[model samples]
Target: MIVLPWPPSVNTYWRTFRGRMLISAHGRDYRVRAVAAAVSAQRYGQAKVAVRIEAWVPDNRRRDVDNLLKAPLDALAHAGVYEDDSQIVELSIRRAGLDRANPRLEITVEGA
Candidate 1:
C-alpha cells in the first residue's frame, strides 16, 4: 500500500505552448514516482495485479476519477512495485468522500 498527495490530472499535466505539447505541470511526476519508489513493495515479475484507489478531495471539488488514476499507476510502475500497469487484472477506483483539510490518494495493490 502507498499513499500520496493528490496529483494534477493528466489533462492538467501538459500544456500546449507554441502549438507543441510540453510538460507544464512541475514536479508532480517526479514527486509521485519518488514517493512510490521509496515505499515500494518491490513486487517483481507479477503476472497480474489488483489496484484499489480511494481518492480524497475537498468538499466542493469534483475530480474525474479516471484522470487521477494514470499518475499513480505510472508511479507504481516507476517504483517497480509491479512489472507494468498492463499487468493490472483487477482495478477499483472510488471516491471516499471529502477531507477539507487534506486531500490525497490512498492506493493499495495485491497480486491477483
Candidate 2:
C-alpha cells in the first residue's frame, strides 16, 4: 500500500511549448512528491499486478476519475514501485468523496 498526494489532472500534466510536448510544472512537482511518498517501496520487477486506488478529493467539483491515474502511475514506476505500469493486469479506481483537509490517493498493489 502507498499513499500519495493529489496529482495534476491530465489536462495540466502535459504542455505543448514550441511544438514539443513537455511535462508541466504541476506534473513535475507531483512526480517528485509521488517519488518521495514511495521512498520505501520495493520494486515488483515485471510481475503481473493488480492495483486498487482510492481518491480523496479536495472538492466537490466534477472530475474524471481516470484522469488522475497517469501521473501517479508514471511517478510510482519512476519511484521503483514496479518496473512499469504495464505490469498491472487489473486496475480499479474509486472516488472516495472529499477530504478537503487532506486530498490524497491511497493505492494498493498485489500479485495477481
lDDT of 2 by residue, 1-112 (tens): 7999999989999999999999999899999999999998766878888889999999999999999999999998899888899999999999987999999999998887
Model 1 agreement with the true structure over 1-112: per-residue lDDT tens digits: 5777777678777778899987565535655554654374747566788889898886666557888876677767767788789999999999988888987888888888
What candidate 1 gets wrong by more than 4 Å, as runs, is: 15-42
Note each model's CA RMSD in angstroms.
2.7, 1.0
Candidate 1: the clashing residue pairs are none
lDDT of 1 at 2: 75
TM-score of each: 0.78, 0.95
Candidate 2 collision pairs: none
Candidate number of the best lDDT: 2
